[model samples]
Target: MDDSGLVSFFRVESCGLYRIRQKADGEFISDGFPEISKSLFDWLSDRSVLNTIPWDPKEHTRRDKVYCKDVHFDSYTGDYLFVLWFANSEAAGEVGEVGEVGGIDLNSKVGDTNNDSEKIDAKNSTGKELTIGKAMYYWFIPSLKLVASINFKHSKTDIEAFTTYIKKWFDNKNKHPNKT
Candidate 1:
């Protein structure tokens, strides 16, 4: 959970730049991190569950919900970075808010009322309407007061691919301790 170690790992493993924050002090550990889109940032920051939970450092958290349309960072590429907020243990037992999509919940109200229509209509690369649901994975390392997440399109394939990639990266790192 060392800040430098986390930064180094993400530098090598992430498809895009990752964000890391010191949970205890609200200090950002990521250098030159771009601002998350306003509506998306407000939506996540408003989640009371994220602030109330007593996160266990040993447990990794994953949540699937109808969160938002793809969130674009303030960069030239307009890259989408799924916002993975810290989750509470209680969230697993509770139901999410209902959304436009059937059987999925919007979870929270987006901040910008003017953009509600735009945010609700999530689409895929093919321009087909895709579900707004996303699977977010969060790691809360209390020992280091750090919470880190890397998010992408939600799918079984994407999850497996990320896992496999991380495993291989770790395997290589373990095999060559002094390489970095």
Candidate 2:
């Protein structure tokens, strides 16, 4: 958590799209795609109403479609951790083409709640949106207010090896605290 009592919050969509946010002066730091942002806002609005109304299967299905995975936080490092999975690039052909990267159609126009179509322009992205053929592991540090680290794994074995290394490092840190 930061000095303002604001902790970094993250949300990851099923297609590996993600956004990080922190409440500061009534504004949010968001990097989600336009379609994703609309979907998330709609889901949140519906969720609030669902609490007052009876359970509905359609709403449950809608909720599932919006969020398919969980984002975890590493307490030791104060890092918000998550993984982004991508399709095999060799099978997909190229990276820049729509649906060839992270399954997101970059060229598609996303509409707002008022039904106005809004294109996802370059200004909305941070240049790291097109992650292809790799599983990306991210660590966002709240104190730094930025993504401190990102590791890309090309195979299951690579992911496992990195996971083991992270666990070992955390264990070692636990065993030996720095003496000031």
Candidate 3:
């Protein structure tokens, strides 16, 4: 193999999203550092929490009627490693809108619990200071939740840690199908 060894960190949070941090030192792109706590709203966008919408604005044009943001973010393992750097782009546009729209906000109430959440390591590696490759982020449908993400080996990304995480939003959508 032209490259040495490849590593990946999977941080799955309650926000319904999973983070896959890819690491390959020499062939890496972004710096290797754990993604700590990004803001709620921004995190959603950065995490591509809107692309999961199964409905198309041009057709249903729904997902446009909410103001979302995580109140808390925590992985099963809780790997609160130091954040190196992170950057994300959109294949369509923002998180929500019409065929041309972009952005995702469903009025969340996750609150400030994320700060106190446990900070677990990347399980295998220290996830301290390393190099990251490509940063991949995706979202779910209907609830417009975060599903899965993958970072490729590049020159700017930090893939030292893969802390699996899920988004726990406090929105109507988050409510069970059969509410009291």
Candidate 4:
């Protein structure tokens, strides 16, 4: 699929900044525009940015209302990067409304090592029935060269999952460049 088609399938709300630079001799030069920067990359990678959607001057910050939707291509690295942004809070909870999103409570009985569907379902505020044991296929998006796919559920996605996705992307890019 092309870029537009991937965005449509993922139901992306906004596109994040992308930077493509090349090293000539020793100095790095921007490919074309200068909108994307290392700082923007750092900001996008930061979890705090995911929870900090702008709001009215008086309202309290609401992390529950926002979450990431999908992975986007990193032009320079040729790997898909997780980009988080705002979406309808209710829609965020519905299955298939968005892509590759899930929720979890770190303090819950579910340990970090296991994605216990029963524990996660029981802990989820949405109280939706668990679609456990279903094979999630989006883990690798070949069209976008994405090594990791996301599972969208009604729970807040865990930070470990995001980190794992990044690591997988790097490993795949290095070990199987064409596959990613």
**Model 4 alpha-carbon drift over 4 Å, by segment:** 1-34, 54-64, 67-80, 85-89, 96-101, 104-120, 123-180
Candidates in order, TM-scores: namely 0.20, 0.25, 0.18, 0.29
Q: Of 1 and 3, which scores higher on TM-score? A: 1
Misplaced by over 4 Å in model 3 are 1-26, 36-42, 45-180
What ranges in model 1 sit over 4 Å off?
1-9, 13-69, 76-80, 84-180
Models sorted by TM-score, best on top: 4, 2, 1, 3
TM-score, structure 2 vs. true: 0.25
In Å, residue 70's CA in model 3 sits off its true spot by: 2.5
Local accuracy of candidate 1 as per-residue lDDT tens digits, 1-180: 322211111222222123445665333333222221222333344443212122322352342222332233434443334433322223332323333221122333332232222223224142423233234443323223333454433221234433432333333322322222
- Mark the regions of model 2 whose C-alpha exceeds 4 Å error after superposition: 1-70, 88-133, 152-180
Worst 10 residues of 4 by lDDT: 31-40
Query: Scored by CA lDDT, what does every candidate get?
Result: 0.31, 0.32, 0.27, 0.32
Q: Write candidate 4's Cα lDDT for 1-180 as tens digits.
A: 322112113322222222334653323332111122222233334333223222321363442232233334456553344433223334334533334234432222212233232323332454542222221213323344233434343323334444443333334322322222
Candidate 4 local distance difference test against the native: 0.32
Error of 1 at 19 (Å): 30
Clashes (N, CA, C under 3 Å) per candidate = 0, 0, 58, 9
